[model samples]
Target chain A: MTRYTQPTTFYTKEHEWVTVHNDLATVGITHYAENQLGDIVFVELPDVGAEFATGDDMAVVESVKAASDVYAPIAGKVVEVNAVLADKPETVNESPREKGWFCVLEIKDGAEIASLMDEEAYKAFCEGL
Target chain B: MSDPTTENLKRTPLYDVHVEHGAKLVPFAGYEMPVQYPMGVKDEHLWTREQAGLFDVSHMGPCFLSLEDGIGGGDEAHAKIAALVETLVPSDIAGLKEGQARLTVLLNEDGGILDDLIITRPIGEAAQGSLYIVVNGAVKDADWALFERSFQGKAVLTRADDRILFALQGPKAVDVMSDFFPGCEELKFMHHMPFELSGTSCIVSRCGYTGEDGFEVLVKPEAGLPLVKEMLTDERVKPIGLGARDSLRLEAGLCLYGHDMDPTRDPVEADLAWVIQKVRRERADFPGAERILKARAEGPAEKRVGIRPLERAPAREGTMIEVDGQPVGIVTSGGFGPSVDHPVAMGYVRSDLAEPGTKIDLMVRGKARPAEVVSLPFVPHNYKR
Candidate 1:
């Protein structure tokens, strides 16, 4: 059984994954990204009501070694932020694709999903690294 | 000669072991050392705090120093060697007992810190009256030069660059090591003893940087990899790298030589006054001892303190720390502490703002974040005897 993603979800070159069921797409970091990041120490999420264009920097993930920005997969309005991450950032390392989900967005352009890499291509890209 | 920058980067004796364990290798101090392993920095940091972790510190220089002679070389050699070393550091080397170790700073004549080093007097009555020293990797060349020019032919300095040094640290370190070296469990902190491992004679020092019960083993470079593999075969031992080493030390409130300290920082300003012994401070011997003493009495203008950011953002090294509207100091070492589960940083600020609970601001990429000075280590340091 699949744990973190549905067959309909997609991933990005930066290793963020988004699961879309309708107008809303739930976003989180990929397992590969979390592993490379070492331990998730602190996570900065965008404001709940903030609007973003496709590929805009919306969040930040920091590890002991370095910090990286997590970009939005598609243009949308941030509906909810992951409040649990403030106290327990390691959740991203424990379950990067599930409980570690960063934010939910109201997808402004549903067609943007086609712009992202599919599951097969994403897995191959991660393996190449 | 080929361009020095393009020359091959050296590898420590245990470089292959790090690769076999899937460690991320990075260039450090002119050697390719492991930065982290497959378990990653966070797990390695916590596991080392909870259990035992093995570190390949062979890149650091371990050397022996003493007086030399051909015919008349008994008590006279010991006296000369002791006097020569006493000039370089402020430690009471003449009074140090056999097998005892002292942490001392190598100071410049201008009262700036050169580096911090560990000096062991020696062991056994039959051994020669030489001292063993382990110094930082980056400044080993400078340390060698200082000893050479100061002692000249009067004292002999033998470099042990071909040796391997491994640190086994954590609460269970002694238990794990005792399984191999039966007598190691009895060694106290800052103490060392000569022991045999796999039929090879080695020196195991009951000292470490992680604020945990641990031992640093010095062995022949050729035999280092096999020992590391053997130690790691046990479930309790894991391979740690530079990444975790830095984070663990930060969490323990230990100073990293170049990042947290430099020639510009004195022992007093860095809050390492305990290392400046009273003998040196009173007698005012050794380089820069006078300035250090004066700083201690009158107080250092700046002080190092811990900063905890109010937001989930991190204030990294080189970031500006400000008070009210003026810049005070810069963050020296900053990172996410795995044990504390938060971003923690250390830096120097004006003495008046060094008190805990004093509000401050950290400029992270031109954006100001709320911060405050708090007690160091962010997490409690648990050093077992």
Candidate 2:
């Protein structure tokens, strides 16, 4: 099992996780998304400062098997992209929540969290799979 | 998890084991194969390179061809069987040694490839005397048709669908097999050793698509579960999926049948002239031998070459390759090479521009990226001698 430094603070239906720090939410793939993707090769993150409505495509993550679009969990403006992924995309496999953070978004709509799955629900969903 | 393809596709013998181990099963080659298990493709690929990875390739077709006892006796029997097959392929079966296998291409008269296959002379112990063969899964029907129509009375082609095929590939494959079969260490590259794998008689060959020291095991389909279980008991071995298999083979510069060569691409253009033995080339018995040998001597209009994508962006299949702003060829197989830590691909370009180090451009998502035509095998092969 992969060790994550942060608990499941915030998770999207598409299986993205966000660790909240002040107004910035460091977004990365969930344990489920990483496991589903197999091995991540290239990550195409949105440009820094890009704005998106809830559910907009924020990034693209490609695994050896196929490519997937990372959707926004909540309405937000991209503050920073994970430039480190350009060199080490496999970090998402090793440190999914911490070092593999896709981007830091400045939260625009906090209510979007209410619609997202909580830790217990997400764990249950993963179990049901 | 909700794919209709998975519901309809056939499961391999390792299907339950894959599910038990949390493998993400996806449809591949008509079977529900694990794309990856708990460990991801990057980890699985690296582990296979360093250690070993178990692959369920049971979907691949295996068959045996036996020559019938003709009314005209011995030498006539050999002559008639060779003539029938030689008309469809580009190999001299008349010269194949007992128990020796030869990789050959089935070609159309216009010099196009039908499919690639490995044919082995499984004589004596296996049966009266038969030629064992394996071909790509996707084109097995077409290949079988070619055999059935051509070999009518001279030989009988029997498909071994009841058998299961497994590939244990990596630098540590020999070590893993040696732990089970003591004399497996003596099996040289491209050689086969018939052994009892967990009380089931099987054929273990020292050959694999991955450019690594590995073994391809053919066993009874019912024995697949127990065999895979026993093999995976070693910590060095992990179940790998088709995803990693593609990257590993691409890195090794091996061709994927339909992608790299098809009915329109001949062996010379595909750079597979090595499979055509000198005797076969001289005999001129195989189909399209006239066109193939002439192209071998004079070269073809295009040749397959490797491409190194300039950046992180991958060049997928069908991406156009250009040189100096003009279209030259198209990418046949392209992706991020997990083992090499960069994006690499293979495609056919004009013969003049196929040389290594030639700068080229790959049109990716409407943008052109700088690329170079490099010699195949972006990653070195680690085959045992």
| DockQ score of each predicted structure, in the order shown | 0.44, 0.48
Once fitted onto the true fold, the runs of candidate 1 whose alpha carbons sit more than 4 angstroms away are: A1-8, A18-26, A49-56, A72-79, A104-115, B1-7, B70-76, B125-129, B310-312, B365-370, B377-385
Residue-level error in angstroms, candidate 2, position B269: 1.9
Clash list (residue pairs), candidate 1: none
- Among all windows of 10 consecutive residues in model 2 chain B, the one with the lowest summed lDDT is B70-79
Model 1 CAPRI rating:
acceptable
Q: In CAPRI terms, where does candidate 2 land?
A: acceptable
Query: What is the DockQ of the complex in model 2?
Result: 0.48
Fnat for every candidate: 0.86, 0.62
Give the per-residue lDDT digits (tens) of candidate 1, residues A1-129.
Answer: 223334378999989998987788899999888987877788888888999998788988988898798988899999998888988988999988889999999888877888888899999887776
The Cα local distance difference test for each model comes to 0.85, 0.81
Question: What TM-score, to 2 decimals, does candidate 1 have?
Answer: 0.88
> In DockQ terms, which candidate is top?
2
How large is the i-RMS for each model, in angstroms? 5.3, 1.7
